[model samples]
Target: MDAAIEQPTVARLITAENREVPVSATLRYRAHDPLAVFVDFPAEAALDGEAVTWTFARSLLDQGLRAPAGHGDVRIWPYGGTRTVLEFHSPHGLALLQFQAAALRRFLQHSYQTVPAGQEDVGAVVERGLSALFDEV
Candidate 1:
């Protein structure tokens, strides 16, 4: 199996003025981090002109595709019939992004192909995490 799956996509950033700006992003999932999904934004998308990555639960993305999900830093919900909205909050500020539902679904499907849902090797993930932590200590 592939170590990771990455899908490049274009997302619309909803500005405070209620305008949409196109942004480049990548959705990533790795077998090694079975429970997590990552969204990567390039430097041009950030105010500081530095790349940023946001990590959230894979299950959250799946649930959000169908309905509203998440209550903390990240929130996701379906918008209309064809779009999905993802909101991320940070100390710096908040970012609202819109993506095509079909695109997100496709990415999820590809990730499942690599590491099927409910079959994540959580034990192996834990072992690796602990090993890394102890090595740093």
Candidate 2:
């Protein structure tokens, strides 16, 4: 008997938005799966820092990626000050997402500025950003 192997799905990097920040800043995404996605933004563009790196990793785990279908989990890791890893896990399989340093910075800024009122969803802004990256708009 022959064993079948599942091929790893290639994740696509997407830019949600771009702006000049005395340099340049952008919001990007890499889809790990239908349930999980990765997001990135610049920390400093000129020089990525630890705080910026940590914030982006935390936000992706704390926000961004979600299992709208209700069947997966998103995981994140900060790689030095240049990148963040987002992983999605489900009964079916796993997916990995990566974000650029600049994009992550922009995302963290947007995420912190907006806070929902009582009974309102706080994740709406993040969701919209993700949707934009996915071209769901």
Winning model by TM-score: 1
Screening candidate 1 with a backbone cut-off below 3 angstroms (N, C-alpha, C), the clashing residue pairs are: none
CA RMSD per model (angstroms):
1.1, 17.2
Residue-by-residue lDDT tens digits, candidate 1, 15-129: 9999999999999999889899999999999988999999999999999999999998999999999999999999999999999999999999988888899999899989999
Write the residue-wise lDDT of candidate 2 on 6-124 in tens digits: 21222223223432123232332222221222332244421334212111333344343332122236555555566555555546455444555345445444333332123224365
Per-structure clash totals for the candidates: 0, 10
**TM-score of each predicted structure versus truth:** 0.95, 0.35
Candidate 1 colliding pairs, count: 0
RMSD of 1: 1.1
Q: Give the alpha-carbon lDDT of every model.
A: 0.95, 0.37
Judged by lDDT, which candidate is best? 1
